[model samples]
Target: MIQTGEKELKGIIPGSWHILVKFWPQIRQRKLLIGSSLFALLLETALGLLEPWPLKFIFDGVLLSRTDIYPDILGFARGLSPMWLLSLLAVSIVAIAALRSITAYLSTYGMALAAIQVLSEVRSNLYSHIQRLSLSFHQRFKSGDLIARVTYDIERLRLVTIKTALPFLANVVTIVGMVVVMFWLNWELALISIGIFPLFAITTTNIVGKIRKETNKHRTSEGAIADTTSETIGAIRVVQALSLHDMLEENFLIQNTKSLQEGVRSLKLATFLEGLVKVLMALVLALVVWRSSLLVLQKTLTPGDVLIFVNYLKTAFDPMRQISKQIGQIAKAIASGERAIDILDYEPHVRDLPGATKAHPFYGSVSFEKVSFSYDPSRQILHEVNFDVEPGQQIALVGPSGSGKSTLASLLLRLYDPTVGGILIDGRDIRSYKLDSLRQQISVVMQDSVLFAVSIRENITYGRLGATDAEVEHAARLANAHDFIMDLPQGYDTIVGERGGTLSGGQRQRIAIARAAIRHSPIVILDEPTTGLDGASEHAVNEALNRLTRGSTTFLISHNLRAVEGCDRILYIEKGEILERGTHPELMAQAGRYAHLYRLQNDTNEIEGVKHVLEA
Candidate 1:
């Protein structure tokens, strides 16, 4: 199995640059949209540079009557009266603003759209990859954390890419354009105005690391909060029954407070950086005004030139100031991106082999030839015990909880590969078959049958996509689910609550059996199918299970020995090793552990029945 260690989780956090590199391929795929957005950005920057020129001309040529100072581009305006010049400059300002707004809209909209599309694809890919990861990987992580990574983390990346990163890019471009123009106008003052940039860089660099660290902590806390919420809500019935509301609320408050603290810390760091940038900008502005006033006194530069220099200085520094403000958001995005990238980079431990092929139709014969397995090296789940079943045979696996009964069933379904030996189907190594194809031939009805929040018909048809309505009803009938389904408010169209919570346990099990029956697979694995059901419900579910397993090779993993009495063979496992194998009668004759446990269970049931009769 692919192990995720604490050291690995804490190691080598990816920086912003690394995040960009990781997502470059997805970003590259939308080249045309990005290219157009860049074009618009450049155009907008050019327009911004022009915005100040009108004021410059109005100040020098028209207002100050220094028409002689007009550049060649505006020489033609010198011949015009002051009134006409003012009118033209006013018109030019409006025109420039209008055009700049248009290009800004185009650039922002284009980039935002592209970011949404690209990240949507990333989200989809991440979800698909999560689904394909080994069961062990999922077992190691909280479902809520995974859900947060898929949904909340990706949303953070999208929001920052559009709301923060895109505008930051445009501002950077504007700063570059303004800087060049400032230098062309007055290199000495431009150099002096930009002198504080090094400080901004230093301040940002120092604070960003702390901000990113805090943001990562905040993200983790949020994931923990998500986990708490999902767990609490998923088992709300149990929680309420046990009166754990206040305790769970207290736990949620703890996580929420931690998240709030971390988020505030990150924002504080960003605010500190922004404040430092503003202070540096003010210092630079004071120096520029003082120095340029002297130049104005010496007549080396016009007041209009001074105005342009000041304007360029502020405009150029604005992007840096904005970046300092958004640094926290950017850091949070990078942290979220790394979480997503870690999942994308993970290799599933149970994926198909290079030469694997789709399995041929199964004959339902299965063999565990000295098969041994472990989730990890230190804890072996299944010991090397051999077993074989003829086509259409029913095999029962009885064991104490955590004694590898379910692990054997999981191996048969290829949920995890054996660590030591090989499992074979129809005399061939199970690994030779593609995972989907091999799994498609075997159907499983877990102890807790999970159902989506969809209509009853949809849940039944989920067994075999595109199954006809007749087939759905027929399979439902086979599982004894059709009658109750028809009596529902919307009949088969009735929507189930999450995990089929709306239905009785027996109803859910029967629907699950219907789902398995619809597959018509040659092999079926039942893991405590009738567990936790009332006596009547158990009888109904057992009848349904009998119909579902008819004509298929079945593996039954159940605690109720009476339920497996009719199986062709019984394997009694203990501590990952099967110590007894025979029919129920044969095991009873052996008077071993199986018989002892069965007798003890029967005695307990008899006492319970007597107590119930006395109470009645």
Candidate 2:
């Protein structure tokens, strides 16, 4: 189906043309394949032109005894008996038909192969670019919309070679050859046939223009449907919990209905263009036949000559008909190309600079120096945040939900660069290191531990490529996941469902820990790693965390007060600043915000304990 947008086609005429011109280099890279395809196309056209000649010989020489008509054209039929001449012409027609079929197959298949190769490369490049873009870029666009641009949009571009280029080139060659031979046989009839082309062109351009506009709308609606479906399905758990099935269905129906209406409108316009072309073709054919009959009766042209003229008339206009029919498909492809180019033309905001150096393995020392950040200038998320961590230190960050705790972790990962000032690792500005190399030194596990729908082993080893089987098991054991993994039917080979939904919340967190454990990075960030676990699962995970944190510089973010007591130091963060920084007991002695919140939680726990004892 056609997939594109109107704004995507804002400069589409020039934009699509530029994309086609840019693709010329890749197309030339497949010179041998395309050359063979072009040769086959030319051969097919030649074979098509030969098809009517045999009929002409049979009509004039064999049936009407007009042997003088094509004495030189069909030299074999000149001296043969009528029956033998007809047989010769019949054999020639069959041979031409067979060759045409072979050439048509070769041309279509060869072009399709080359188109697939070029678009495959395009898709690979586009996907890689999207992956490299900053988090802000992804935030601006939906995953489903990006997915549509990379897949369906690229597919539409591939259609250009098969639907537009192949047909246009082959048809043009056949039309030119037929027109020349038509003029040679009867110039007057040929003129009458060619005269209808201007009107056809005018009608085609007008109708196809409308079709293209409607197609843009339809394609956009389809993208909206895709985005809505992706978002809904991704949050299917919440949707089911909130009983939003009818609401989501109504929302999808609105998008789908718009798409259906636009699709019908585009189809109607295309049908009108096709019908208009058919009428034009009939008129041209009628004019050619009328003029050819006059010439035949006037003794200026033989019956066979009139037959060739009529056949040539039909053959010459066939390309125009085909092109008119293909115009809608061509427009859709152009719109898609424009959208693909939109992504290709984007400059990633967070790419490594030229001459960027590969980072040495981090010694685990990290510092945020007067760093500031804002998604918008008016409302800053992190304001002049400053902090320092010694090598192999375990620092706990405690704060309200929007108090910039996760933002700090994100900055350390360099998923974003600070708007002002800088962050340093081992006394080197993080931006000075190659992005990939810098990221390799730090491992992260967030609240929602995302896992692919792959085998449990594959998901774990994703943190450290080329990890041996034994090493994978070791990491799993360290994360308290090995026993449960062994209980599964496939042991470590069991396939996890999407986002690891097949596993329980605690199971998923343990797997995430196992994945992080295998990384063996000197720096690890656990943001609410054990937040949603049960009492037993939390205890198990906390024990695993104790083992995993040994000798590693750890940044632990959590809301559970009890979870932070074991850290070497706890930082009470509020409103983008550290309100308190000390050991758990040290903070309690100070009687600050941290002490007040801690004692309040302790009082609530004591009350719960007393109530439980009384009920027993």
In order, what lDDT does every prediction score? 0.88, 0.85
User: Model 1: per-residue lDDT, tens digit, 12-103?
Assistant: 24476677687788889999999999899899989988898899889988888998788888789979999999999999999999999999
lDDT measured at residue 202 in model 1 versus the true structure, 0 to 100: 59
Give lDDT tens digits, candidate 2, residues 12-73: 46755788686777777888998899899999998888888888878878888986777565
Prediction-by-prediction clash tally: 0, 0
The CA lDDT at 266 in model 1 is: 91
Clashing pairs in 1: none
Q: TM-score, each model?
A: 0.88, 0.86
User: Any runs in candidate 2 off by more than 4 Å, and if so which?
Assistant: 1-16, 71-84, 201-280, 315-318, 604-616
What's model 1's TM-score?
Answer: 0.88
